[model samples]
Target: MPSKSSARLAALTVAAACSAATTLVLVSPAHAAAVRIHDVQGTTRTSPYAGQKVTDVAGIVTGVRTYGSSKGFWIQDPNPDDDPATSEGVFVFTSSTPKVGLGDSVTVSGTVSEFVPGGTTSGNQSVTEITKPTVTVLSSGNAVPAATVIDARSVPAAYAPAGDPAANNSVNGLPLQPSTYALDHYESLEGMNVQVADTRVVTATDPYTELWVTVKPRENASRRGGTVYGSYDAQNTGRLQIQSLGRTADFPVANVGDVLEGTTAGPLDYNQFGGYTLVANQLGTLRSAGLERESTEKQKNGELAVATYNVENLDPSDATFEAHASAIVNNLKSPDIVSLEEIQDNNGATDDGTVAADVTVNKLIDAIVAAGGPRYDWRSIDPADDTDGGEPGGNIRQVFLFNPERVSFTDRAGGDATTAVGVQRLRGKAALTVSPGRIDPADTAWKSSRKPLVGEFVFRGRTVIVIANHFNSKGGDQGLTSHYQPPVRSSETQRHQQATLVNAFVKDVLDTQKNADVIALGDINDFEFSGTAQILEGDGELWSAIKSLPRSERYTYDYQGNQQVLDQILVSPSIRRGCDFEYDSVHINSEFHDQISDHDPQVLRFHP
Candidate 1:
């Protein structure tokens, strides 16, 4: 004899508890079980578990979105475990909650429910409730002592058993088991906390900002052979400041080539280019610490060296700027003149200021200095008042960084100073002066939006010309209005027009400086097989440095799971020989969508 209202309330509570328990059982046991955002699509079991209750899921907050008047916030869970097939999901709304930013590791519990598609759905599935969502602070711990550092070469290969009895007895002088064994049997220890010790063969340390230490694994250790990761924020140079905890403590620091011990609490986050990165929350010293510096010679004449990178927008933030700058000064193949793209200008800056504000030019200089690159100097043109009508988007653009000691600019062209290039272009070009130079300013055989930045440099007594070009982006077009709009032919038209201009410019360079050593490099925003690229390479005026290699190794960018050649360095035949120009399309940006920029960088090296 219970009242109807009371009975209904009790029934709902029981259903919620049952649902939560069921979800927990279905989720994998390796980590906490939770609902993911990607999976919420259709049915409760199929879609991303919206309007369903889940428990014990762990992940880093990739993104956060808030609605009007403190209605709620959607937390994006980017845990690898939260696959679409699994229930661990996102779109968990919190009512009247504050706000959460990106990169925060959090754990949430709540009823998995569907959000109203366009805010129009019925039933409990429309908006689920998170009765007891809890977030735990997990960034503070003891710094791993420095004595345990290991090197990549010291660790032994992993082995599994082979099925053949006669062959299983011994493999590579080691005892084999009954089943087939893998030489590299290390996979599971990705995101777990562990301590490592080894020698550092390579050290990329930017002064007071970040340090990347690569240690070879110790021999016969239980862990697999690989590199160990260690990093320290410059703001916390003398201490460890865990971003999650918002607290700081005195911690030990280690230098490059220093044998040290350190603890890594989680799995190495692999970059798009197959680099295993360890995000360190704590670092300390061990016994018998010492440094080993090797003497290196400066670049001699006649060496064809060039550097290229995406720069990931080259933002002004301390962490991002330092990380990218360090990589350019250290991690790259070390070119003489670096052609860079995606250099950004602050929204309201009238001039290119310090790296802390206007990152496009100043930050590159700062980063080079931090990486101990004192021999390098650079120059750039700010597009603030350029008559070429400004770039399409008005934020991100391209620039260049060079080593003045190695090559000097004899003539400079392009930029906002004068619209030598047309108005439709985004990034203005420049022609630098160099030794063994071959630039003739009087030549007007080129047609471009933003004029091509061309320059001449001396290498091994031979003069070569370098042209840095950034064509119109495929982001939007005249009639299309916006990217999300349909009827996309307008975008195609603009891209085609941009390509035509680029092709004409390339032809013009070759026509003016016949048989001259020249290279065309930058983000073209077009694939190799596309019409734009074809036109540029028309009549064999330009040849792809990558296509010269095996077909299997020609991709420079990956988008939507499709790999394409967007960024390239095309070399004229004059510099193709004796100057075996090779391109290494760094796979850093395209692999991880979270990379600072959306494009992977292309590097070219020529040995004369």
Candidate 2:
């Protein structure tokens, strides 16, 4: 036998010769070669004979894994043209710049090599290494160039789920795919800029920095056994970051009928407080394409109109206001008075240096103008000035915006005004007094926690006491217990307390104004079936404006794999008569929550 050194030298010589031959084959002037991701074959594509200098390979990213402190990601290309049952011929190792996700179609090019694969305890196929593969994403639309945007819902069952986890409970009826890849992948994208599109519903818009958007893959796609599905929660949902561009002095900076576009770079991640969700990073507007305009004809009759939606956090920023102003004005059924939650204020002052309280109020006023509606002159009880606790910038509360053209500003009431039952422990409390003269109390049920902003609005011929509530969250089980409470230990004993307080207030208001119509709306923070909601409905006197419709039409928030009825528009029997309230839980926030705000708005349209 030859000496050890001599043997090694011989092996090297053989490898060098093989490499040279491979180079010649690739450099030949006469032969032009290309390989589709689906066509590559063999059990192991190793260097020398295995390391072919393929120019390009096209296929969808079936799987992806990241390792080595953001060094790069490993992508799997399981092409249909390849061995279907086994991922044998698919590319095992591909280098990326850390912005790739599963189901994305891409074309990669570079010299392929073989090395030992990592992260496996069992001894398996050890081939790895793809040198300098230039990746070109093939997603559709100009949002991300070269990236192939897949519907994800269009992916096969083996790769994507057909319906949400809660709905179908499997990958097209099969067991749910392990979320190991999603969890890890989300961690990698945290704070990084990314974009996603899907048809889910939005839930919450608190803690303004990170907006949570939930998406639910359609169910029909799964029943057909051709598509895959995913659910929304802290994990798998997509996310977008909220950011502001400069202000414009135009009448309608961006109308409700304009498509919003923008880009930013930062880590993107997912968290599951109660649902799987996507959080965006470095979000900003790219452009606004005008959408189809709705007929602006106002209803001839005087009716009590109500609507609800997750505005994705209408912050006190000019760019955000402009981008969404038109949609809020036009897409909405043009209700006489609009009940809004998640109206944010700047820190201590408005962007223009006005008092933060005044700044927040004015930003909304300006947004109404941009949306092509009459000026929204309104008021809130608290000035959003409390800085000791609660959400930063005391201005992060629910507010009512009314079109002065339809309703006049009469008297303001509610918010910190009453020391009623369970109201002492609450910190930021107050209610706005509006025209038509109605009294609303800060929903004292969540006094120990984040109190609900409640107020009464007097319409043309009726008194509508509207309670805007932000109740105990379903993020954790804390709200489920009878003694559950927040830090202050106020009246938030259980999730139901928030609803209970609202129920009591509504009952009291109805008792006082027996013939008056009461409309309650806002982010209740709990689902429809929960005990908290039962209190508000009390003996069927209060009706869920959306429940009168089909099951598929009742959801206002998407959680985990199930769509839960969180945000709602509850109306007393008095208002339900002449007011055929049309309520729509718009899915806009579901698509862009991570970038905008988490909670969707609830709009009520009815004859006053």
Candidate 3:
């Protein structure tokens, strides 16, 4: 979708034509038939003619991308092929800036190659390309091919077809079924010019100059305009990423539920970040729908309000402390207990073996008091230098911020990063041996992850057990748009192990006291319906309170247009049986352009 320099076009054409003639003379007559763009693309993810040279393939230049590291021009055959499984368009990758301009009728002679965007290890589908090409420009100013219209009707409801079992459950070798599967439909039109009209934005525009829009306006629609990822089966196939081919200053800043007015057309591209993207040559007008953040209600006199917020590697150096203070004071109404995740050391990200976070934690607490909130005190144990896996050298860990006026923290001696906490029976009740202590820190499940912090608190003559956790993140997992059908979630293996250890710890406390009040809350880093959540909620030991909301509202994070839950607060059987609790997924961030954090904080209010 970008244009190239026309000054060197004539010279490159002369040189390419000579190279083509010499290359063709060495080939025999058996494989000299004229090849089309569809033949180079073939019916599968990889081209059938990969590594083979084809001569005199004619097509009109639809788009010329002259920018970025991968500079290339897109060409589509004006002539039609009857097969829908094959794409008629392919990219001609020039090592540097392309010499050809838009609408140039050219015959390309090049070796067909399948280029994987993030290498083969990324498990991404390969993009068919013509590399080291020789070009012959027949004419200029030709009419470009008609852009294919992609709408709700064109995209299939099913996300993808099951992969073949014989090929390690990969869909790479399977013939594309454009009419049956949505991924296949996009694969069939990989490099072709496609258009969408009047689509609704499902994700806010980020600093990366990209946003997501949904063609099917009603697919898993949430009240706040994001597409809810309720289950693994439905991935909301209509969500597509859009990036402008023009100047970045000309790109529109949009939020969820906003409307992209009129038609926007571009060449369909596959990349490492988002699977399929539309590099728009003609962008649509952005119309704001006026989406706003949400606030939760204040807790009653006897009810205790608890919340969990991932401040996204917060340190004293960040400018978002005041904004986060306002969120706790105004949006959350100053909860009694706040489990804060990703609290970094004093000098953030400068790994010099400093692990204490008093400077960072006190700054946030001071900001909260300045925002007309409570005078809060914090409790946390600094992990061994670089033991917790987060922004390296920052030594990120979980900390509990409690209002002394509302609740009291019961602190005992001898709690550290390496020592394991134990449950004790004292005065016919379950209590933590060390108030703020790690749970199974020596376990292999928590090798480089944050250990769950166990603490005891008292409110209205009742003692309560609280566990703050920041589990292993989903870093190395394959995305939903992977070449392997039903992509492998390798990151979940560690999260599952972490969940099992936490579940055992909770079970230990419950076994000591049957009616103890337990609240396990923080960024779990997995979906509610995922295997990690199931292990955490083992045998009625805990219940995810986020599921208390409707199916549309059970999300705390937004990634690539899918609003899913990576943070959760699971209560014990005593809290679940009473049904005297309220849960809220406060939408202060994750849906806005100017966000302090990428996750929305969750709140739970109940009486002990």
The lDDT values for all models are 0.41, 0.42, 0.88
The numbered model that scores best in lDDT is 3
Query: Quick one: ranking by lDDT, best first?
Result: 3, 2, 1
List runs of model 2 lying over 4 Å from the truth: 1-298, 309-313, 348-356, 383-391, 412-449, 477-494, 558-564, 577-579, 592-595
For model 2, the run of ten residues with the poorest summed lDDT: 478-487
Least accurate 10 contiguous residues by lDDT in model 3: 14-23
Model 3 RMSD to the real structure? 5.8
Tell me the TM-score of each prediction against the true structure.
0.45, 0.50, 0.94
lDDT of 1 by residue, 1-608 (tens): 23434543342222112221111112223444444433332222223444455654455543232322212222333433422222222333444333444454455555654232112211111223243344442321223212112234322232232222353322222322212221211111112222344333122232222233333223211111112111111000111111111122332243323433544322222121111233344443432334321111233355666755666444454257665665565556445888776565653223333222254467557767877765465544444332222232234444556777666654434433233432121122222323222222123322223334555565655556666666655533311101111213333454466555555655665665555566777877666666767666767777767666444445555332224567778777676754555566665544331344556566667654
Q: Cα deviation in Å at residue 369, candidate 3? A: 1.4
Candidate 3 ranges with C-alpha deviation above 4 Å: 1-33
lDDT of 2 by residue, 325-378 (tens): 655676564566666665555543233322244575677567768677667766
Candidate 3 TM-score versus the reference = 0.94
Each model's Cα RMSD = 16.6, 15.6, 5.8
Best-fitting candidate, measured by TM-score? 3
